[model samples]
Structure formats: structure tokens, C-alpha cells
Target chain A: MHVLILGAAGMVGQKLTTALIADGGLGDQALTRLSLVDVVEPPAPAAFSGAVDRVAADLSLPGTAEQVVASRPDVIFHLAAIVSGEAEADFDKGYRINLDGTRFLFDAIRLVGDGYRPRIVFTSSIAVFGAPFPDLIPDEYFTTPLTSYGTQKAIGELLLSDYTRRGFFDGVAIRLPTICVRPGKPNKAASGFFSNIIREPLSGHEAVLPVAEDVRHWFASPRAAVSFLKHAATLDSDRIGPRRAISLPGLSCTVSDEIASLRRIGGEAVVARIRREPDPTIGRIVAGWPTNFNARRAAELGFVAETRFEEIIEAHIEDELGGRFVS
Target chain B: MHVLILGAAGMVGQKLTTALIADGGLGDQALTRLSLVDVVEPPAPAAFSGAVDRVAADLSLPGTAEQVVASRPDVIFHLAAIVSGEAEADFDKGYRINLDGTRFLFDAIRLVGDGYRPRIVFTSSIAVFGAPFPDLIPDEYFTTPLTSYGTQKAIGELLLSDYTRRGFFDGVAIRLPTICVRPGKPNKAASGFFSNIIREPLSGHEAVLPVAEDVRHWFASPRAAVSFLKHAATLDSDRIGPRRAISLPGLSCTVSDEIASLRRIGGEAVVARIRREPDPTIGRIVAGWPTNFNARRAAELGFVAETRFEEIIEAHIEDELGGRFVS
Candidate 1:
């Protein structure tokens, strides 16, 4: 089946594309054609047998969504968004890219009016939840996002639910946890430390821990993220029921637990590589995030997340470090 | 103190302005300057001694908010919007007027950040809640809006809360129940029948009941609506707490209750004027609406609603019928 991946140039997008290319399929359906789109043209498909088309365009631009949607892909993966830090800093840019972009794409699919409903897999985030949350946030908690990025994602979830209810498209919004041990160089996302402290330290590089050691967070691996995308693409829509959005399952642990996991896996030397230097900005932002979530709906839907941080670290090492540790 | 009404030409806006004029004051603050704005020029203020400036302008137009905010009124009552039925029918119009217009006004206020924080009373609606609600929806129920109108209102509530939390403005969003016995010629609102069946029959005219007699709904009189706005405006910001939005108290009753109250007030003859004609479209919409809501927050904040449908009808007669119903 033909697949369209929006924001195909980004980190998660690149990983998801690589996974699809490596597998050559999602479930029983083979990848006959892959359409990749981003603000910058995506890298040429690496050794793909399937027909690959790359388009560079901004979804927030008025007509860009229509142009991309005209090709009628069977499955559409909407992964485009400005990161949390940047979105929170720039108000107009945040709403334009995160909110307007998602809406424009949904509206384009709606206006097609040909009764060709595609499966729309939307990438939401844990940012949709805010402070004063229950210890274990249930799937039914109210969305009161603290930042503009969270607000935009929450709005997108609402729009997706409504549009799907209207039969414009079959939509599913997966609220991804902070993907731990994120490969490659760190960026400006507030949650970057969740990955940085683990990935950098394991690679024999010193990594700064900006928050208190006791600070807790939810985590999933990059492998789990790809699994979610693939599962979301093929899962029976009826199983999702009426609520199109769900918080995905993940391992919940404190910062100390992460350090302990590192010690257990790579000894005390690896744990010693994490330097404690608190940044108040990051600390304040992290304070509002939910620490743990009970994703009953996602669990029931057969979605899986790494139960252990060691395995998460191992996955990152195997994928990014060629299964070798620094000498 | 200067007061600005954004939709002064609309039904509720005109009535609210009239009430403010008749009261001769808002809380203890005497009305010094009144600015009335609408797409059509609002009626001249007849009772207030203050200079009344009536301007015809569309809030959706660019730079209109800048002009309005430049006046730097002490209080802004934002009552502007395309109605629910119209908003649901036209998506572009809905987003333009409801979502973008609200944002523009907010941004304009934020830009005027010279320690000038005005009290902004935004009119939200009961549409923020949708189906599968508890028998009596509590303060913290999830906002799963079933219509475009509800979705937009829900988003507005989120923005109002966030902006207020950020100290951009002293804002409060009051989600008013559907006004019972709206005193005018019936229009296109699907909920119009709720008012029409009561008002038209009381006025010695036949009215059609579109849904079943068992369908229930929440309501408040136009007087209550004005009271809500006034209370929202004057409320101490501290009492509003972190979440600046509130669901105003509304009387919840069934159609039979309304008919029973109508029969008691105007006798059996008025009840006889009602004709049953079930329209599935309206039934579907009404079914998704919450019939009973426990507005604990609003009550705690000192806003009240009429308890009995008879009181609601009596309110209509006293206000619209000039203290006498048609014989």
C-alpha cells in the first residue's frame, strides 16, 4: 500500500522511515510506494525497491496540504511539529506550525470529498498533560497543557477526533512518552536530558543532569516508537472506540532509577559520567510534566513499551553505536 | 471606569448593555465611557451619562483588535461570534471569527504590556461538554465536544486559562447555558425550539417541538446570563484560582417539566399550542448535549441560576412581555 509520511526529515521521521525500509512492510501490507514530505526535501530513499517520492513543502502554507493529499495515500503519518522549546518561545510560529499546520492537513483530507478515508496516524505528546496531575495519569484526564506546544497538540487531538467522527478520515493520535536514549546530538527540547544523560554517559561522554535526581518521568525507546507507528497504522479502528487519542504505555522511573540502571548495565563508572548541574529553566519546565501514566487503552490495544531502561540503552547502543562501547 | 462590549448589536449584548445602563453602574465602578462595537452599529446608549462610542467593525479583520485595545478600556466583555449552528455549518467562518478573532484580541492585549492588565470577561458556552456525560457533570469532566461549536469553545477555555495563568490579563471564561425563552422571532439555532416552544405558545402562537418530550436540557434566563457576565467581570481574581474558566449554574429539566411549568403559568390552552414533530438531526445534536450539570465552581464563585422552569418562563414574561403575558 502507498504511505505518506509528513515531516520525514526529522529525527523520529527518519527512524520510522528507516524501520519501514528495513522491514519492507507494515504488517501484511507491503510498501508499494513511499511518499516523504518535509520543510526541507528528505534525503533520497536509501536503496529502496518501492517507488519513493520526496516533496519539500510547509504544511502551514495554504495550498501545500492540498497538493500533498491529492495523491491519496492509504496510510498518512502526521509527524510534523515545531519542538516544545522553540514552540514555547515563539508564539506565532508555534501556533502557525503546530496548530495551523495540523488543521490545514486535516481540512485538506476533508475537502477531498471523494469518500476515500485514509488512516491518519497523529503523533501527539505527553506535553498534553500538565501539573497537578494524578500520580498515575489515566487516559481520561483533562488536557490542560502548560505550554503553547502542549496546547497546540491538545488542539490537534481535538480536531482529529472531531474530523474522524465526521468520517473525513480514520484518525488515531498516539501520545508518545519522552523517548529515552535518543540517538545523535542533543537539541533544544526541554525533555532532551532524559535521553542525553543516558546516551552521552553510556558513550563515555559527560552529560549534564539539569533536574533533581529524584525527578520522575515516563520513557519509551525509539524501537517502541516505531512499533507504535506501525501498530497504529494497521490496528483495527473499531478497537480504538470513539476516543481517537490515547496515552501510550511506557516505563515510569525517577532520575535515580536511570542512574542505577546505567550502573547495573555499564558499572559505577558510567553513572559517574553524569554531572549534576541544575538549570532552573529546565527544572521549572520538567516540574509541570506528568511523571507516570496508566495507559490502559493503549495497553489493551496491544501497543508495547520497554519495561526496562537497560534494554532501552542497549537498543540505542546497538542502533547508533554499532553495538560497541567506547574504549 | 470605561467598559467595552465587543458584540453590542447582538441580542444578549444589547440586553447586557441595557442592564448596565439601567443599573447606572457595574459593581461599585461607575460607567464613565462606554464603547459599543459590532459589525453593524449598535444602538445609542440611552441611560448612561458617559460618552458612548459605537463602532461598526469585524473582529476577524486584521488590526481591528489593535484599534480596540488601543482604547485601553478597564473592562472588555467579548461577546462576539458566529452562532453555533452557523459555525458548525461553515468551518472557515467558525475558525476565523471564534478561534482567530479571540487569539488576535488576546495578542493585542498582550502587546499592550505596560503593566496594564484589563479584566476580560469572555463568553464561553455549555457546548464545551458533550455526550456520555455523568448524570450530573461535575467540575472536572473531560471536554469531549461533539460539535464544531463545542470544540471551539473548549479551545477558548484552554487559551483563557493559560493566558490568565501567564498574567497576560485578568480573564474569566463563563460557560453560559443555553438561554431559555429567548425573546425574539425564532431563528435557525437547533436549540431555538427550546425557547420557541415556550415563548411562542405563551405569546398565543403555535410552536413546534422538534424532539421528544423526554429530551432534557440545561438552561438559564437572559437575566441570569447578564448576571453571569456582571459577576464574572467583578469577581476577585484570587477566587477564580488557577483555572479562570467556569461553568455557570443552569437549571436542568426535561421537556415535560417545561411543558408542565408552561401549562401551570399560561394554563392548558398554551400547552395545546405545542405540536410534536420529531427531527432526527436535532435529536442527534440534543442527545449529545449534557442535560444535567453540577456547576459547583460557579456557585462557589457566587453566580446563580433560576431553579424552576416556571421562574424561567416568568423571567421571559417580566422582561419581554412587559410584565404581562398575552391573554
Candidate 2:
């Protein structure tokens, strides 16, 4: 079946693309064609065998969505977004890119009017939930987002559900965890420490831990995230039913556990690579984040993630470091 | 305080305007400028000592929102929307006017670049919540709206709450119940039957009751709705805290209770004026509506609605009928 990947230039997008290329097949069927689109030109795949097409364009533009959908992709993965910090700092830009961009893409699918029902997997975030969270966030939690990024994603999920219910497309919005050990250089994300604490340490560089050792967060390795996306792409419509969004499974643990896992996998020398310098801004932001989630529905749906932080570290080592742990 | 009323040409706008004019004051504050705007020209007020500025323009148009915000009124009542049925029928128009228009206006206020905060009392609806309700919806109920109208309104509420929390504006989103005995000719609203059975019977016209008598709905009178708005305008922001949106207080009654109240108020003759005609479309839509609400937040905020259906009918008679059962 033909598949299209939007936002193929980002970290998750790149990993997802690599996974798709490596698998080379879904279920029993082999991939026939693959299309990738993003604002910036995505790197060419070295291992993809089937027909591959890449386009660079802004999804927010009037006809960009239409152009992408013209290929009649049986499955479409929409993993595009402006990050949390930028979205909060620039209100207009956030709404324009995150909210308006998403709506335009959905509308384009609806406007096709040919009764074409494509499996659309959208990437939502845990940011959709706010503070004073229950000890364990249930699937039925209300979305009262505290940031523009969260609000935009929440709104996107709502629209996706409605549009899917209207039979325009088969949509699934997966609220991904704060992907820990994100196999790249730390960016401007406020939650960057979730990745930096592990990524930098493994690479023999000390990473700043802005929050307390007790500060907890929900996490999934990059490998687990890709698997969730692929599984979401193939899930039966009958099984998913009307509630199209699900919080993907993840291991919930405190910063101390992360450090312990680092020591377990890479020894105490690696653990020493984490520098504790409490930045109040980062601490306050992390404090509002949910530390635990039930994610029962997602588990029931056959989506899985690393239950142990060591497994997460191992997965990162295998996927990002070519199956070798850096000394 | 200067009052700016968006959608000033609509029914609720006219009523609010009439009430303000008749009172000659807003919560003991002396009369001031009244800024009225809509796609069509708003009707000329009967007479008022305060200066009135009427702007005829489409709020959805580019740059129009900035123009409106330029006035920087102290109290802005946003009473604009495409009704449920129309919004559901035309997706593009609904998003353009309802969602984008609201966003533009909100962003306009933010982009003002000065410390110009206004009391923005937005009129939301119970439509924001959908089916499979908990009999009596509580303050924390999740908004899983079944229609485009509800989705748009819910998104607006989220934005309002976030923006208010960020200190961009002092905003309050009051989710009004279906206004009972809406004083006007019967429109095509799916919820129109809620008003029709009461209104048409009193006007000596035959009205259709589309659903089963057991079907319950939340309601508030036009006077009560205005009271909610006025109260929202004057509420201390500190009390509202982080969550700016609220489920306003409303009377909950079944269809049977409504007919019984109508019979008591206007006699069996008025009751006989109602016809039982089952409409599946109306039934399906109404079935998803919230029947009862706790509205604890609104109650705590001192915004009250009539408790009995009879009091609602009496309100219509007192406010619209010159204290006469039949005009």
C-alpha cells in the first residue's frame, strides 16, 4: 500500500521513516510507494527499496495539503508541529502553524469528496493535560492545556475525531510521551533535559539536570514511539471505534530512576555525566507535567513501550548508536 | 464603563442592548459609549444619553478584528456565532466565522502591544459537551462535542482559559444553557423544539414536540442569560483563577415538566396547541444534549438561574409579554 509521511524532517519523523524503510512491509503486504513532505527538504533514504517521492513545502500554504493528498496515499502519518517553547513565546506563529496548519490539512482531505478513507495517524502530546493531575491520568481526562502548543494539539485531536466520525478519513491521534534519550543534540524544548540527561551522558558529555532528582516524567524510547506509530497505522477501525485518540504506553519514572538506569547500563562514570544545576524555569515547567498515566486503553489496543528505563536506554543505544554503547 | 457588543444585530444582542438602555446603568456604573458591530447594521437604540457607535462589518474579514480592538472598550460582550444547524450544515463557513473570527478577535487584543486588558465575557453554550453524559454533568466533565458548533465553542473556551491564565486578557467563557421560550419566530435549530413547544403554544400557534417526553434539557431564561453575562463582566478575576471558563447555572427539566409548566401557566388550551410529531433528526441531535448540570463554579461565582420551569415561563411572560400570558 502507498504511504505518505508529513513532517519527515523532524527527529520522530526521521526515526519513523527509518523504521518503515527497515520493515519494508506492513502486515503481509510490502510497501509499494512512499511519499515524504515537510517544510524543509528531508534527507534521502539509503535503504528504502520501493518507490520514494519527497516534496518540500509548508503545509499551512493553501494548496500544499491538496498536493500531498493527490497521491492517494492509503496511509498518511501527520507528525508535524511547532514545539512547546516557541509556540508559547510566539502566540500568532503558534496558532498559525500548529492550529491553522492542521485544520487546513484536515479540510483538504474532506474536500477530496471522493469518499476516500485514508488511515491518518496524527501525533498529539501529553501537553494536552494540565497540572493538579490525578495520581494516574485516565483515558477520560479532560483536555485543559496550559500552553499554546498543547491547546493546538488538543484542538487538532478534536477536529480529527469529528472528521473521522463524519467519515472523511480514518484518523488516530496518539499522544506521545516526552521521548527520553532522544538520539540527537538537545534543542530548545523546555523538556530537553528528559533526553539530555541520558543522551549527553552516554556520549561522554555532562548534561545539566535543571530539576530535582525527584522530578518525574512519562517516557518512551524513540524505538517504542516508532513502533506505536506503525501499529497505529495498521489497527482495525472496528477495534479503535469512535474515540480516535489514545495516550500511547510509556514507562513513568522519576529523574533518579533515569539516573539509576544510566548507571545500570553505562556504569557510575556515565551517571556522573549528569550535572545538577537547578534552573527554576525548567523546574516549574517540569513540575506541572504529569508523572503517571494509566494508558489502559492504549495497552488494550496492542500498543507497547519500554516498561524499564534500562530497556529504554538499550533501545536508544541500539537504534541511535548502531547497537554499541559509547564508553 | 464602555461596552462593546459583537454580533449586535443578532437576537441576544438586541435584547442585551434593550435591557442596558432600559436600565440606564450597568451594575450601578453610569452610562457611557456603546460600540455595536455585526455583519449587518445593528438596529438604532430607542434612546440613550450615552454616545453610541455602530460599525457595520464582517468580523471574519482580515484586519476587521484589529479595527474592532482599536476601540479598546472596557467591557466586551462577544455574542456572535453561526447557530448549531447552520454550522453543522456548512463546515467551511462555520470554521471561518465562528472559530477563525473568534481567534482573530482574541489575537487582536493580544497584539495591541499595550497593557490594555478588557473584561471579555464570551457566550459559550452547553453544546460544548456531548452524548453519554453522567445524567448530571459536573464542573469537570470532559468536552467531547458531537457537532462542529460544539467543537468550535470548546476550542474557543480553551483559548480563552489559556489566554486569561497568561494574563493577556481578563476573559470568562460562560457556557449558557439552551435559552427557554426564545422570543422569536421558530428557526431551524435542532434544539429549537425546546423553545418552540413553549413559545408557539403561548402565541396560539401549533408547535411540534419532536422527542419523547422523558427527554430532559438544561435551560435558562433570556433574562437569566443576560444576568449571567452582566455578572461575568463584574466578577473579580482573582476568584476565577486559572480556569476562566464555567458551566453557567441553569434549570434542568424534562419535556414532561415543560408541558406541565406550560399547562399551569397558560391552561390546557395552550397545552393542546402542542402536537406530537416525532422527528428522527431532531431526536438524534437532542439526545446528545446535556440534560442536567451541577454548574458549581457558576453558582460559586454568584451567577444564578431560575430553578423551576414555571419561573422560566414566568420570566418570558414578565420580560417579553408585558406580564401577560399571551401577547
Candidate 3:
């Protein structure tokens, strides 16, 4: 199977690339070739003994989607999107890259017209659900996104379902939860604290807790996200039926639970590194986010996630911390 | 107040234009100027003594949206769209006109830049919902459109909400039910039978009933649709909160109800013009349409519709048949 990964230079994309290369295949088909695309040229895999092509091209540009899709890989992982903050800040840039880019890619495949139907795995976000949500958002809750990035993702989901219904391509959109222990420097995202408090403290650095300890949010690990992408790629499209968007399973827990997990893993010293600094702006923002989901449809389809935060922290320790923590 | 109607030549648009002229205003503001646009130049109102401008402009064309919005009409009714059947058949044309055209119009308003926030009444359709619907689809039901037209309208709804949230404009998307007792000749739309059965018989002609009497569907009169548009225009945006798309209230009844109403209105002689011919192709197509909606939100917001089929037929008789039907 030939694989193409868009946004291959990003964090999730890079992890997915490494995982796919190590697995040496997707499902039953052997990986014979790989194509990587992003705004920045992605690194070619060193370990993989297969044909690899890398390209640095902005998808928003005219004909860029067509050029990238010319090879028509068997599996396409579309993870490229402007994050919520940036998209909210620069509306035009966000829509151009996220909405127009995704549409361009879909249209490119459609214009191919030679019965070349590839399995596409698109990464949607929990941001699609705004404030005033049910305690556990069901598989059928309405999507009224408050942010531009969320709107773009929701639009992509609609298009994905429509194109799939039209037999243009088989597609699945998985709405991923916030990735805990994100294995990178903290960014400006409002939800960044969820990862920072865990990742920074375990690395012997102080991290600010923007919201209250009781504030809850949904979470999954980087490894789980990659697994979801793989699972969605190989699953029977008929099982998904018409609604192509699926809210994936994630561990729903309060900030207290995360702290407890950290304390258990790296002792009290590591937990003490989390500073008490309440920012109401971030608090209000995080308060509107979805804390839990039924995710019944995705679960029924065999998609799984860690039920306990301890597992998530352990994965981070083993994968990012090289099996050791600050304590 | 200046009002711009993008599809002023269509049936509902013409009715709305006439009603606005007759009312001499929308709500408290006096109608000072009226601008009409469509693929074909709309006819100027002969009775109204107001500044009337007519233009034959395609919104999908570059610079056309900018030119149309240059006047900055205080109330803009964006009713332009390619119908469902055409959109499903021609993918590129549908996206270009329905999706790109709407975006261009929105961006043009955003570009106006000097705090020009107009009240935009957009006409969405019930096509946004597909089969496997509950007995009564609620206001919060997720939109999973099966047709390309539905997909485009769904995208428009998302964009409308996002742009409204950003304070670029005050927008309301009214998802109109199938307009029953249509005045014109029968068309190729699968749902045309709903109107054809009643309309053709009243016009002294035979009408075909292609489905069983038990096939229930949602409906409203053209006059009710115009009223919904008017109500949506003058509504307090704050009351609407964040979600801008509304499933307008409509009468839900089976074909039996329609025939029974026709019998009471025009006697068995007029009903005898009906011909029973089952077209399985059309039956299957109509079977996939949404049968009902709760429409609680729209009702709460004071958007009313005819509850009885007799009232709907009376409306068509009063509005289109010169207060007389062939008996």
C-alpha cells in the first residue's frame, strides 16, 4: 500500500509517520511507497526500505492539491489545519488553509475520475462542540462551533460525508480529544496547560495551572491518536454508513486526576512543580470546552482509548521521558 | 431602509418583494430603497413609489458580490441557490454557485469594514436532514446531509454562524420545508408530486400521485415562507444566541391528509382528476427525505406556519388562483 501523509512535519504527523514506517504496512497490505507533504519539507524516513517522496507546498495555492494527489496513494492522512488560536486571530488565513485546502484536496481526488478511490483519514477536533453542551455529548449532538477553526473542521466533516456518499472516495473523520503530555514545548493554545502541567513538571520544570483543579476535560495520548488514524484507515467503510464523522473515545477526568497521576508516577516533588496561577480568561475559555462524550458510535466500531490517566502518563514517560521522570 | 434580495425573481422572492412594498416597510423602518438581483433581471415593482434598482448578476462571478453589496443594503435576503436535483447532478456548478457564491457575498460584507453589520435572512432547506430521522427531528439534531445541495447549505449554515459570532453580520438561516400547492407547472424534483397532486387538480388538469398515501413529509405555504423571512429579518439577534440556523415550523401530514383536504375544498369531482401511477425510482428518492421536525426553536422565536392542510390550500387559492379554484 502506498501512503501519503499531509502535514507530515507537524507533531502528530511526524509521530504517525514513524509509527507507519515501523509497522511496515497498513492492515494486510505491505507499504511499498510513502509520500510526505507539508508547508515545510518533511524528513524522509531513514529506516524504511521503500520509495519515499517529500514535498513542501502550501495546499491553499492553486493546483497544489492536484500536484500532491497526482500519485494517488492508497491511504491518505490529512492532518493539516491552522490551530484554533491562529485561525481565530487571522480569519482569512485560517479559512484559506483549512477550509479551502481540504476542499481543494477533495476536489483534486474527484477530478481524478478514473475510479481511483483512496481511504482518507481526516483529524477533526472536539472544538466542533461549543459551550452549553450535555454532560456527555452523544454521537448525535449538533455541532455549533464558536471558533473559525472548529467551523472549518465541521465543514470538512460535511464535505467528507458528502463525497463519500457520492462514491468519490472512502473517508472517515475522527474528532480527537486534547492530547495529554503532548511531548513538546507549551504553545499559546488555551488548552495547552492540560499538557504543560503534566509534561513540564515531569521534565523538572515549573508549569502554570491556568484553571481550577476541579475543571475537567477530555484527553488521549499521542500514541492513541496515531492508532485511531490507523484503525479508521482499515475499518470497513460500510460500517460507518452515511455519517462519516465520529467522536473518538477519550479519557474524561478532572485536573485533580491528572495531578494525582503525576504524584503517583514522579512523587510529590514533581506535583509541586505545578504553580497555582488562575487566569480567568483561560478559565472562561476552557470552561466552554466539552469535558466528556458518549462516543458510542466510535466505541461500537472498536476504537479504544485509555480509561485512566495513569496509562496516559505512563505512555508519556516511556515514550517522551525515555522511561524516567524528574523524581 | 434599503433591502437587497439576491434571488428576487424566484416565486418566494417575488411574493416577499410584493409584501414588503405593500407593507411600506419591514417592522418600524420605512422601505426607502429596494434592490433586486438574480441570474435574470427581476421585474421592478410597478405599484411601489420607491427607488428600485434591478440587476442581472451571477453571485458566483468575481467582483459581482462586491458590486452588489457596494450599496450596503440594511437588510440582505440571500435566497440564491442551485436547486437540489441540479446540484446533485453537476457537482462543480453546485459548489461554485451554492458554496462559493455564498462565501463571496459574506466576504464582501466583511470587507465593508466600517461596522456595517446588516441583517441577513438566508433561505436554507429541509434537505439538510436525510433519512433514518426520528419521528420528530429536534432543534439540536445533527445535520448529516445526503445530497450535494444539502451539503452546500449545511456549509453555508456553519459559515453564517461563525461570521455572526465574529460580529461581521447578523445572520439567520431558515430551513424552509417543501413549499406545497406550488403555482407553476410540475417540475422534475421527486418531491414535486406533493404540490402537483393538489395544484394540477385545482388548475383543471390531471395530477399524478406516485407514492402511497401513507408517505408523510413536512410542508408550509409560500406565504408562510415569506412571513418567516420577514420575521427573521426584524428579530433581535441576541435572542437567537449563537446558533443561527433554524428549522422553521411546518405542517407534517401524509398524502391521505392532502387528498382529504382537497376533497373538502373542491369536492370529489376535482379529486377525481388524480391519477395513481407508482414510479419506484421516484418513490425510493422521496422515501429518503425527512418526514418531520419538532421545530421548537423556530416556534419559540415567533415564526408561525399553517397547521392544517386546508389553510395551506386556502393560501394558494387566495394568493395564486385569484381567490377561486376550478370546481
Candidate 4:
């Protein structure tokens, strides 16, 4: 089986590559070839016997989509996107890369014809929903995206579903919850505090809390995200029906919950590293984000996630910190 | 006030033009110029003193959008699109015209940046929805369109919402229900029978009903649709909030209800003109369409529609049949 990973240089992409290689296959099929694509060249997999094609390419460029799909990978993980902050800041660039790039890829695949259909797993985001929603948003709730990035993702989801229905490809778009305890250097993103407050404190470093303790949000670990993508790629298309965008199950929790989880695992010294600093700009932006979801459809479809924020943190420690953190 | 109608040659376009000319303005502003565009040249409205620029243009072409928006009409009614049947048959043309054309127009308006924000009323369709929904689909029900036309329109809605939120344009996407008693020659579209049944019978002609009488669907009159476009243009944007697309209020009734209404409006002689020839293909297509909608948001926002099928038939008689039928 051949697999392609777009945006293969990003955090989730790198981890997914490692996971796919470690497993030696996907969905019970032996991996014979792997194609990795990103704006920047993806690093070669460490210990894969498969034919590896690591290339740097921009999907928005006219012929780039055609070039990438020329190999006709059996499975495609489309994770490429300009992050929310960058997309919102640079409107034209965001639409160009996120919207136009996605269309380019989809069109290229469709034009290939001759039954070169692949299992396309697209990474959508919960940002596709806006505020003024119920506490637990159901699967059938409208995707009224408030951000340009969300809009582009929503459009991609629509295109993917349509293309799939037209029999051009078998595609599934998974709307991921924000990954908690993200293993990386803390960034200045509004939602960065969700991960920063947890990761920094656990590592015995100071981190600022931007929102209130009661401010709740849905989350899953990066590991869980990778698993969702894999499950989506392999799931029976019959079960997905016409609506290909699945709202994945998530762990709903608040800042207080994160702190409690940290205290329980990392001790009081780690918990004390978190300093309260409320920034209204981040507060306002975060306020408009959906905090919870029923995710009943995904649950019924056999998709799962970390049940608690504690599990998310433990996963982070085991995966990123080698099962240890600073006292 | 200067107004532009993108598809001024089509049925709804023509009606909106006549209505605009009859009223002499939109949103209480005196009309100065009317810019009409379509693939075919839009016929000039009768008895209008205002300046008229009617051009035959294809919006899918790159430079056309910029050229049309150069004049920058105060209110732009984007009503151009290939019908569902055509879009479904030709996938490339559908995306090119419906998706690319929309983006080009939006970008053109955005690039004319000098604080030139116009009220853009985009005419979306109920095809943006698919089956497997609740009997009374709410305003917030997810849009998982089952057709390529629906997919393109749904994508357009997302772009309009995002662009509006970004302050690129003040846009509103109104999802119009099937326009019943559509005043046109009988066409072979799956949905065409809905209009043909009522229209042909009233015009002293036999029409084929391709589905069971129990098959229900949503509808509104062409006049109501015109009013919807007008009302959407003038609505206070604050009431719309961030979700720019609205599932407009529609009268939901079954084919039986339609026949009963037709009998009442056009008498027994006209109802006898209906021939039952159940085509399984059209039946399968129509079965997947949504039948009912709460449309509470549209109602709350002061957008109204016929409550009964009888009223819809009467509307047809008044608007299309010159207040008389084959009775």
C-alpha cells in the first residue's frame, strides 16, 4: 500500500509519519511506498523499508497538485493548511493556500480519472463552528465558521464530500478538537494557553493563563488526532453515508480541570508555575470558540478519544517527555 | 441608489429587475443606475428613467468580475448559476461558474478597497441541504449537500460569511426553496416536474407527475423569492450576526397538497390534465430532498412566505397566469 502525507513537516504530520512507519502498515496493508509533501521538505523516515519520496511543494501553485498526485498514493492525508492566526492576518494568502490549494489538489485527483481514487483523509477543525451554540453541539449542528481558516476548511470539507459522492475518490473529513498538552515550544496563539499552561508547568517553567479558570473547551491529544486520521482513512464508506465530515469525540474540560490534572500528576510545585494573566483580546477570541460537542455520530462510528484531561497530559508525558517531567 | 443584478436575464433576475423598476429604488434610496450581467445579454427593464448598463458576460472568466465591479453598484444581487441538473451533469462547468465565479466577484469587491462595501445579496438554494435530516430541519441543521450544485452553493455561503466577517463586503446568502410554478418551458430536470405539474395544468396542458403523491418538498413563489432578495438586501446586518447564510422560510407541502390546491385554484378540468408517470430516477432524486423546515430564524428576522399550498397556487395564478387559469 502506498500513502501520501501533505503538510508532512508539521507536528502532527511528523508524528503520523513515525506512527505509520512504526506500525509498518495502515489498515492491515503492508506499506510499500510513502510520499511526504509540505511547503518545506519533509524529513525522511528513520527506519522505513518503503520507497520514500520526500519533496517540498506548494499546493496553491498551478501544477503542484498534479505533480504530487502523479504517483497516485492509495491513501492521502491532507493536513496542509495555514494556521488560524496566519490565515486571519493574511487574508489573500490564507484563501490562496487553504482554499485554492485544496481545490487544486481535489481537481487534480478528479482529472486523473481512470479509477485512480484514493482514500483521502482531510483534517478539518472545530473552528468550523462559531459561538452562540448549545453547550454540547450535536453532529448535525451547522458549520457557521467565524474565521477565514475555518471557512476554507469548511469549503474543503464540502468539496471532499461532493467529490467522494461523485465517485472520484473515497474521502472522509475529520473535524479535530484542539489538541491539549501540545508538545512544542509555546506560541502566542490565543488558544496556546491551553497547551502552555499544562506543558510549561509540568516541565517546571512559568506559563501565563490568558483566560478564566471556568473557561471550558474541547480537546484531544496529538496522538488521538493521528489515530482519528488513521481510523477515518480505513473506515467503511457505507457507514459515513453522504456527510463525510465527522465531528470526532473529544475530552471536554476547563482550565481548572487542567490544573487539577497537573496537580494530581506533577505535584504542587508544577501547579504553582502557572501565573494568572488575563488578556482580553485572547479572552474575546477564545470566548467565540465552541467549548463542547456531543460527537454522538463519531462515537457510534467507533471513533474514540481520551476520556479526561488527565489522560491527555499522561499521553503527553509518555510520548513527548519520555514518561518524565521536571519536579 | 445604483443596483447590479448578476443574472438579470434569468426568471428571478427578470422579476427582481421588474420589481426594482416598479418600486424605483431599493432600501428607500432613489435608483440612479442598474448594471445587469449574464452570459446572455439582459434585456433592459421597461419604463425606467435610470441609467442602464446591460452586458452579456460569463463570470467564470478571470477579468469579467473586475470589469463588472469596476462600476461598483451600491447593491449587487448575485443570482447567476447553472441549474442543478446542468451542474450535476457537467462537474467542471459547475465548479468553474458557481465556485470560481463567486470568488472572483468577491475578490473584485474586496480589492476595490477604498471603503467600498456594498450590500451583496447572494441567491443560494435549498439544494445546499441533503436528506437524512429531521422532518422539520432547523436553521442550524448542518448543510451536507448531496449534489454537486448544492456543494458549490454551500461553499459560496462559507466564503460570503467569512468575507463579510472580515469586512470585505456586507454579504447575505439566502437559501431559496424550490420556486413553485416557475414560469418557463417544461425542462427535464428532476425537480422540474414540481413546477410543471402546477404550471402546465394551469396553462391548459397535460403535465407528468414523476413521483408519488405523498412525496413532500419545500417551496415558495417567484414573487416571494424576489421579495426575499429585496428584504435580504436591506436587513440590518447586526440582526444577522456572524452567520450570514439563512434558510429562508418556505411553505412545505406534499404532491397531494399541491394537487388539492391546483384543483381549488384552476378547477377540476385543469387538475385532470395531470398524468401520473412515476420515473424511478426522478423519484429517487426527489426522495433525498428536504420536505419541511422550521425556518424560525427567517421568520423572526421578518422574512415571510406562504403558509398553505393553496396560497402558493394563488400566487402563481396572480404572478404568472395574469390572475386567470384554464378554469
lDDT of 4 by residue, B1-327 (tens): 999999999999999999999999887798889998999999878989989999999999999999999998899999999888888889989989998999999999999999999999999988889998798999989999988889999999999999899898999999999998788886545699999999998898999998999999999989889999999999999999899999999998889999998887778999999999989978877777899999999999999988888888888888877888876
lDDT per residue (tens digit) for residues B262-282 in model 1: 989999888999999899989
State the weakest 10-residue window (summed lDDT) of model 4 chain A: A182-191
Q: Which lDDT value does model 1 have at A150?
A: 87
| Evaluation by TM-score, superior candidate among 1 and 2 | 2
Model 4 misplaced stretches (Cα beyond 4 Å): A187-189, B187-189
Q: Model 3 segments beyond 4 Å from truth?
A: none
Q: Which stretches of candidate 2 lie over 4 Å from their true place?
A: none
Model 2: lDDT to the true structure: 0.87
- The local lDDT score (0 to 100) that residue B241 gets in candidate 1 is 81
Each candidate: what lDDT?
0.89, 0.87, 0.92, 0.91
Instruction: Write candidate 1's Cα lDDT for A113-161 as tens digits.
Output: 8898999999999998888788899877778788888888988988898
lDDT of 4 at A23: 88
* Per-model TM values vs. the true structure: 0.95, 0.96, 0.98, 0.98
Ranking by lDDT: 3, 4, 1, 2
Q: Which of the two candidates, 1 or 3, achieves a greater lDDT against the reference?
A: 3
- Model 4 sits at an interface RMSD, in angstroms, of 0.5
Worst ten-residue run, lDDT, model 1 chain A? Answer: A318-327
How large is the i-RMS for each model, in angstroms? 1.5, 1.3, 0.5, 0.5
